[model samples]
Target: GYNSHSVLSILMQTYMDSSTVLAPVPSFWGLVNSAWNLCAIGKRQSPIDIETTHMIFDPHLTPLRLNTGGRKMYGTMYNTGKHVSLRPDKTHLVNISGGPLGYSYRLEEVRLHFGSEDALGSEHLLNGQGFPGEVRCKT
Candidate 1:
């Protein structure tokens, strides 16, 4: 059985392959495939429009704690075509908790995205601006 991540990866790959021939626009992503319906209709998608005026700070939020067993961790890095990914070894358990999170989470993967120019790269926008690159962590 395939996990949700695997299924999503397959769907994304299929979309990428088909888009080369179809040239479907971003708005038509969901229309091109049922599995990617969220790409068109999802409210909390990537490249989010972050407005600084709407920002609110929570003073009660605690700092995040990373438990690395007080030792070094080893991981393998891979170029997934879309981005660079790092998957840590299972022997070294890295767990994170606190920081507004209700439960502790393990670091599953780390993804890095960058572009040739500074205008386009980040996954999300900051006050309607784009950064040169971004690092995403999957937990």
Candidate 2:
């Protein structure tokens, strides 16, 4: 299977060689909102440190369920320069529900990101450490 991020990065590198150089790609440290002076602001920004001691267990919460209905999903990979985004086929959507969600939500797009090395590329850090990679799914 192809790693979308890797493919996108290669595409971006090729583009960079031909076009006028662009600013740094939007990343976990500097997102599009602040970089472009956009009005949208993230209230709950990521890459925060989540300590296990601060977590609370809720016994009543149901486990999250992902129902694809046995249908095959097709999508295209995009090289946004900042990230490798996935645009799914509008016809077949994945249904995700449960846990604290009140209704099932359909997946929109999925973005994948990774570090230059295997040890440091996660948007969310647990106790101040990065993971090998991360998948940012939009729903």
Most accurate candidate by lDDT: 1
Candidate 2 residue lDDT tens string, 8-118: 221011111222233332232235334423213445534455555665576889987767789887888997876688877877777656774445666667778776865
Cα displacement (angstroms), candidate 2, residue 12, comes to 27
lDDT of 1 by residue, 1-139 (tens): 3222211110011122421333444456678667568668888665565565765566989977778899897899999887898888989877666774445667777778766756465666666666666677666
The lDDT per prediction is: 0.61, 0.56
* Cand. 1 Cα-lDDT: 0.61
Q: What is the lDDT of residue 99 in candidate 2?
A: 77
Clashing pairs in 1: none
Instruction: List ranges where model 2 is wrong by over 4 Å.
Output: 1-44
The segments of candidate 1 whose C-alpha lies over 4 angstroms from its true place after superposition are 1-44
- For residue 49, model 1's alpha carbon misses the true position, in angstroms, by 2.0
Query: What TM-score should be assigned to candidate 2?
Result: 0.61
